[model samples]
Target: RKYGGAIETVLAHLQESEERLKNIETFEERKEELKKILAQQRENYLISAREIHDKRTKAARRFEKEVETNLKAVALEKARFEVRIDAPNAADLQSGNNRRLTAKGFNQIEFYFSANVGESPKPLARVASGGEASRLMLILKTTAKAGDAEKSVVFDEIDVGIGGRVAEAVGLKLKELARTQQVLCVTHQAQIASLADQHFLVEKETVGKKTRVSARDLNEKEKVEEIARMLTGAQITETARKHAKEMLGAAK
Candidate 1:
């Protein structure tokens, strides 16, 4: 009785098993198809990577030139800046020697710099001092045209190790940069502060055992007074005030 009632169920399972075995026998055929697809995809990837490499090379040349010019403006006239790009070429990709792929097409970029005359250019991170780094950042950030004006850029102590003419030049460069986008700069130099579209004063107050730090925007008169104080140490001389006024006036 068991064989009579259950024979159909056993036969159904056997049929399903035979279908699975058929699929197993065709596995080698599917593997070959997948291999062909992979080769086609790899060829497309190499072609696209090579195209990206060429565009990067063209842009890097222009970037190097602009950075060199701005370096001169920031009293880094003797400084040399380079945009170095390392990537596999079409020939390298064709030989299947470099099959590694990345999101950015296998291109690596680094900034090289020489801060003094007669010095060979080296990797920027290894050779740049605090002051040189500040100047270089300003040039790179301002000269970069890759993004929109909505991007906010902040520069802290950008005037480090610079004063007098160089400070004023930096202020001018900052002003030019601000014309396109939002820029916030922290500076001790009166020259830079005077050119700001808006100025905020940061003060630290000690209340009992606690210290409170606050920042408040300055009005026009307050801005002038603060600038004058920056020019003169303890006493704000008439000459300093007049000079500060002139600087602000010239900026407008």
Candidate 2:
């Protein structure tokens, strides 16, 4: 009876070993299946990212051309603008690939500009002047999808480093933009202020020892006089007023 009981115990141990081995095998199979599913998901993501990259490439080409044309309108006639989109380097790919993939897709974008003919295109930080930068920003805004017009867009002295025909162009562009959205522009140039549908003159007032700043909406006569003042500093000459009237009329 002792020998028989010992034999039963041995058989029990053998059965438990076999069961454990089967469980390990089942686990290995499940792990392989999970790996395959993960691989397929990664491949699908990569395919989608490549599709997005292609669409962005096509759009960038068109955007570059249109921005170059707009730059010409802003007096950078020789400027060449480029929208560069490129994939990450091989080193970045080897370091877990996740760094390259973003909500925007698996590519990087940088705006490049050549402000003058015969010059190589460089990043906007290195090449574009203040006026050129402003113009580029304005053009980008113009090209972007229209947003809620109730959102006011303010431009403070964007007309800096520009005057004459370029200033006129900027004013006209602002006016056009204002049709779809509200734009508030602070400019020393009479050209820009003249384009405003409503004009306000900012002044500083001193009462006793305290000085305060005030802005008042100008009437039509006041608007003309303000433009004349902008043209002739503290002096409002007849010629300046006449020129201001002509500018306002022409802007209309």
Candidate 3:
């Protein structure tokens, strides 16, 4: 009887051990399944991150290349060009997120230039000379028109720093650019203004106590008078008008 009882106890212990081993095996299988799911999710996240990075990098590079090419073509070939992409400030961020957002792909772009051939290019605000800044601004406007097919460009006092041949060059550039865009230039330089397809004059008139602004499109004869006025300041003479006519004819 004792031997039989000992056998029964041994059998019971063996069954208990088997049950525990089965439970452990089941837990390990579940754990392996969880690991596979986590790995898949991580792989998907990596792919998405790579795609975003590639897209952002490509857009930035394209914009940089276009601006650089345009700058070179607009007489700043030796000038260095740079693009700054700064994240939006805290005010621009979402309510709960630290990341800021901007309409221009989370960044803003500013153009910088250097006038001297060997000088390092700096921000547009850093350029101190009035003439250099005017020309730089003109070059940027001209470049923007060249890159687009459906845009119009206007130049107001763009020849402020240029004279002689440089003034003539400015005129030619304006004419060339006008072939692709509508160019309206308000200029004091007869050399520059004479190249316009159509010229309008802005004059101030006193109506009682208040001054009113008036503009008129000049006819051929009136255009001569206006050009003469520009040439001689407030004094228009017969000789000056004739000289203005000659300059206009030469420009054509």
Candidate 4:
């Protein structure tokens, strides 16, 4: 009986060891499977991020190059353009969550300019004078639309800083752009506004004590009156109205 009890105890010990080994093997197999899944997910995320960055980089480079080329074609050869991209730290790029390109992304892109020859290009915000800023904005916007597949482009206050021949050049540029994109400009300048496919007058009127905004789509006769008001400001004289008519006819 003593020998039989000793044999049973040894068999119990061996069975416990086998169970423990099996448990350890099962845990190691699960760990390996999890590692493989995680690696595949990481790879997929990286591939998607790279694809997006490539597309955006391509578009940005194309637009910037085209604008620079067009500026040189015109006499505005002093203009320069750039796109700034922020990159991740090496440690973060290697170990952390996958990074992706966004609309704004981790980057800040700004248009830069230097109007005068031999001057370094500065940020658009640093530009001085309303006229210079307006012109710069127009040039940037116009050049951006140069390769646009759109059918219409609208300019609000495009003539803010321009007058005389410069204003005429703006009008001509608008007309040229209109060849591809229908150009709509809101202007105080009779010269600039006259180039529109359609012109409407915006005005403020006081009814009782409340001032309200109103817009009028002017006919040929009313367009003359509206242009006269813009030229003379509030008091529309006969001479100013006649001048508005002449300006309209000249614009044609």
Candidate 5:
């Protein structure tokens, strides 16, 4: 009886061990399934990212062409503007074979420019002057397709260092761009100010010990006067008003 009881206990222990082994094997199988699912998701993400990269590459080329064409209108006749897409190599990633991605894309963009003939294109920050930069930005805004975040574009002193025919070109360019997008340009040149769909005069006044700055929207009469003032400074002459009227008429 003792021997029989001992055998029964050993069999029960062996049975318990088998159950534990089976449970362990089942858990390992589940872990492998989870790993496969994670890998598949990663593949899908990479595929989508690659598709986005391809689209941006094509769009970048088109954007570069449009901006270059507009640059000529801003009097940069010999200028060369390029939009470069710097895509990363697979070897640069942490996994060595995986894509390096960011929220924007897997590529970095740089605007390169050369303002004069025979000059090699250089990075925008390294090459373009303040006026050149402003004009370049204007060209970009004029040609670029508006995104969700770009509701309005404002230009402050884009007419700086530019006048005469160039200023007129800038004015006409801005006016044309405004047809497609909302544009607010602050300019002191009579040529540029005359083209505004809505004109506002910015003035500063001394009240007591403090200085205050105010912007007042101009009516037709006010616009003419303000544009005349821009043409001849504080002295609004009759000739300047007649010239301002002519300019306003030509702008339309």
Candidate 6:
């Protein structure tokens, strides 16, 4: 009985194999049809890609203008920011080979910058100093609209290589930006730190061959004292405390 059942199963398998061979016989005709369909789809993709490139070009121009305008606010008045979009020109795109395209498409966008007048713009990464990059990033991320309530922005050492009025300007810029989003800044500048809504003291200590870094919040008095400490280092003179108080009062 088992041998009989096995023969019947083998017959069912042979029937399925014959049906699959029939499909293989017609596969060449279907394959050619699919190739033509895919070619049409490829052309459609190129058309859509061109539209995306055009939109990005227009948006890049607007973004460049906006960045240059805000550059003046952070003392980069003479600096020029440019957005360079390198893509297959209309002729190359029309070639329809699609071999030159990357996963991100045919466009490669880059930022160029000149930090001073009479100098030609170079790539932003190669040319911009830390402070310049920081301010540029801040301006780029800043929105003209208010209330990005769910977003938190973090700034680390944005005040580098700047001091006096420029530092104050940067601090004010952070304050203004904080109105829209939560701004967390790490800075040695008392001007900037004093503008913060809350203050934290971060300290590192070593014990029994283990080292740890910890951060703790400061109260109103501790915040004032901490700002004063930033102003005068570990010494914390009375004059610096008074100045720190004045800064806090001004913030209010």
Best by lDDT, which number? 1
Model 4, runs deviating above 4 Å: 1-34, 44-62, 68-79, 99-141, 146-155, 172-184, 205-210, 225-252
The list of candidate 3 runs beyond 4 A from truth reads 1-109, 115-120, 125-133, 141-150
Angstrom error of the Cα, residue 165, model 3: value is 2.3
True-structure RMSD, every candidate = 4.3, 8.0, 14.5, 9.9, 7.6, 4.2
The candidates, ranked best first by TM-score, are 1, 6, 5, 2, 4, 3
Specify the highest-TM-score model's number: 1
The total number of steric clashes, by the backbone 3 Å criterion, in model 4 comes to 0
Clashing pairs in 3: none
lDDT of 3: 0.67
Candidate 6 lDDT at 249 equals 87
Q: Give a tens-digit lDDT track for model 1, residues 1-252.
A: 433458887787779889999989999998999999988988888779879989999999999999999888888998988889998666777777755578778788889999999998999889988778877888887789443488878888688878888899999888888888888888899989989989999999999999999999998888888899999976998898888889888888
Q: Write the per-residue lDDT of candidate 5 for residues 137-184, one digit (tens) a residue.
A: 888876774523446778876887778888999998888778777888
Q: Where does the lowest 10-residue lDDT sum fall in candidate 3?
A: 94-103
Better candidate number, 3 or 4, judged by TM-score: 4
lDDT of candidates 1 onward, in order: 0.86, 0.82, 0.67, 0.68, 0.82, 0.84
Error of 2 at 201 (Å): 2.9
User: Which residue segments of model 6 deviate by more than 4 Å?
Assistant: 1-15, 89-104, 143-154, 176-182, 202-215, 229-243, 249-252
lDDT of 2 by residue, 4-101 (tens): 46888878878988999998979978899999998787678777888998899999999888887887777778888888898977576556568778
Candidate 6 on 1-252: residue-level lDDT in tens? Answer: 433468888788789889999889989998999999988987777777778889999988898898888888777888899989987777776676576676566788888999899999999889988778888878877733444879987878688777777778888888888888898888898988888888889899999899999999999999889989988899989999999999998987
Residue 4 miss distance in model 3 (angstroms): 68
Clashes of 1: 0
In model 2, which residue pairs have backbone atoms overlapping below 3 Å? none
Q: Give per-residue lDDT, candidate 4, residue 207.
A: 98
Deviation (Å) of 236 in candidate 1: 1.0
